[model samples]
Target: EPEVTQTPSHQVTQMGQEVILRCVPISNHLYFYWYRQILGQKVEFLVSFYNNEISEKSEIFDDQFSVERPDGSNFTLKIRSTKLEDSAMYFCASTRALGLASAQYFGPGTRLTVL
Candidate 1:
């Protein structure tokens, strides 16, 4: 079965460094999103992308963060300046349908650790 794959399940980085987390979303899926969960916090939406543009973004998606669809299958999230608070599990998700009918499928997650 097709599934989203995220690379480097865990990463440790120094503060203020740029980091790129990669994910390959399910084939034929149209909508994509990035969410993060702190060790004890609820999952928070960072951004959602469709049609090569951002559909919706949360306050957490600040200038230091960006996302891109480098190709037909690969989606990536880049943090230009990492902070200690950036440590969390970043999940990549996708859905074939839209609106309330669509169910998002998530990856295991890339655990970003900033020190």
Candidate 2:
């Protein structure tokens, strides 16, 4: 079965630096999303992308953040200026369909530690 893969399971960066979290979502999936879990907090949706543009984005998706589908299989999240509060587990997810409650397949997650 196809599964989501994330690179650099853990990263440590200084404040104000840039970071790019990489993800390869499951093949044949159409919807891609980014969600972050801050330690013990709940998973919060950052953004959802489809058809090349952002389909939806939460309030947490601010000016410093961006996402892209560089190719057919690769999805990337870029943080222009990271802050200490940005430290968290960044998860990439995808679903074969999009609806009221389509279950998403999540990657193991990339832990971003901003110092």
Candidate 3:
């Protein structure tokens, strides 16, 4: 089975430094997305990307967050400035089809911790 992969399984950064989280989705998957889960909260959607453009984004994906598919197989999320509250597990997901009914495969996640 195909699965998504993330780098720097764990990250510890200062409160204001920039951080880039990377992901590689299963081959042939098209739709890509980013989601985060705070320590004690449910997973929240951040942004969705397709055909090199953002398809949908949540308010949480403010000016500070950005996503890109720098290569054919790799997708990345960059945070311009980290905040203490930004500490959480960020997940990368991908699906073959579009819309609410498609199934998405998620990466194990990158845990970002700010101090």
Candidate 4:
């Protein structure tokens, strides 16, 4: 079975530094998303991408955040300036389609720590 995979299981960076988180979603899935969970908080949606363009995004995805599908297999999220509040477990997820019935496959997540 195929699954989403994230790189650099953990990342430590200084505040104001840039960080790019990478993910390879299931090969056959068509929609991809980025989400983050602050320590003990609920998972929050950041952005969604499909057809090589941003489909939707939440308010948390501000000017500092960007998403890209640079190639066939990789999806990435770049945080232009890391902040203390940006430290969280960032998750990558994908689904074959967009609907209530479609189940999303999630990656293990990449933990980001800002100092």
lDDT of 1: 0.96
List the global CA lDDT of all models: 0.96, 0.95, 0.95, 0.97
Please tell me which predicted candidate would have the highest lDDT against the true structure: 4
lDDT of 4: 0.97
Cα RMSD, each candidate: 0.7, 1.0, 0.9, 0.8
lDDT of 3: 0.95
Report the error of model 4 at residue 99, Å.
Answer: 3.0
Which pairs clash inside model 3? Answer: none
Residues 8-77, model 3: lDDT tens digits: 8999999999999999998898899999999999999999999999999999999999999998999999
Candidate 2 Cα misplacement greater than 4 A, ranges: none
The digit string of per-residue lDDT tens for model 1 on 1-100 reads 8899998799999999999999999999999999999999999999999989999999999999999998999999999999999999999999998667
lDDT of 4 by residue, 1-115 (tens): 9999999899999999999999999999999999999999999999999999999999999999999999999999999999999999999999996656899999999999999
* Better-scoring candidate (TM-score), 1 or 2: 1
Where model 1 places Cα greater than 4 Å from the true spot, the runs are: none
Could you give me the TM-score of model 1 versus the true structure? Answer: 0.97
